[model samples]
Target: MEIGSSESQSECNLSIKLGMEFDSDEHAYDYYNEYASAIGFSIRKEYANKNNAQGM
Candidate 1:
């Protein structure tokens, strides 16, 4: 199943790049979730922004 914008499903860009920005975390989630679904898989948040100094 597709999971992106209503404008078009075929336009989804499954590739990721550096310095991408979204309006909100929700928008980022939607973009990634769509990419994951396109590749025949689903995504979940295991952890966010892990850093050695932060101990996350």
Candidate 2:
């Protein structure tokens, strides 16, 4: 996904998908952090791992 300031919603949707299931958590966070930085926002670590599957 191409993340940019003008593409906040698309970026957010991609972040949601990444949170659900992407290549890896580290990668997801990297992308999310980059996006957040570009858009002047900050995300907590707790929120980053909220979508982790717990034996489901």
Candidate 3:
């Protein structure tokens, strides 16, 4: 995903809160991945606890 200047800036100011909604898990990953890259970091592995059946 190509982030424009303004969008990239927002990514730079990345924050996490409880109950954040994303289009999909990949979308969430991309969002964080971009933020991490901009801050001179990379994500090698990801582990999240989610209850898909219960939509938690």
Candidate 4:
């Protein structure tokens, strides 16, 4: 979770900073999705494991 001024994550901003602090992208995405997603969301372990393996 390296902080940066990149357009994608915007590490200088609050959420990304907090996300990096949390150290779990899936959790952070879900937390953000609480407001961002109109419908409920799910964290699939298959996706998590694949992404974790790929360092996504």
Models ranked on lDDT: 1, 3, 2, 4
**Local distance difference test, each candidate:** 0.70, 0.60, 0.70, 0.44
> By lDDT, is 1 or 3 better?
1
Alpha carbon deviation, residue 20, candidate 2 (Å): 8.8
Model 1: CA > 4 A from native: 1-13, 46-56
User: Residues 1-56, candidate 4, lDDT per residue (tens digit)?
Assistant: 33343354432223423425446877666665542332322343343344656677
Candidate 3 runs further than 4 Å off: 1-18, 46-56
User: How far off is residue 33 in model 2, in Å?
Assistant: 0.7
Q: Give candidate 4 misplaced runs (Cα > 4 Å).
A: 1-20, 38-56
Looking at model 4, residue 33 earns an lDDT score of 56
User: Lowest summed lDDT over 10 consecutive residues: which window, candidate 3?
Assistant: 1-10
Per-residue lDDT of candidate 2, residues 1-56 (tens digit): 44443655554544434326659888877877876765657776763335456732
TM-score of each: 0.51, 0.43, 0.46, 0.28
Q: What is the lDDT of candidate 4?
A: 0.44
Better of 3 and 4 by TM-score: 3
Q: Rank the candidates by TM-score, best first.
A: 1, 3, 2, 4
lDDT of 1 at 41: 65
Once model 4 is optimally superposed onto the true structure by TM-score, how far is the C-alpha of residue 38 displaced, in angstroms?
A: 6.8
User: What tens digits encode model 1's per-residue C-alpha lDDT throughout 4-43?
Assistant: 4334445655655679999999899999888767655678
lDDT of 3: 0.70
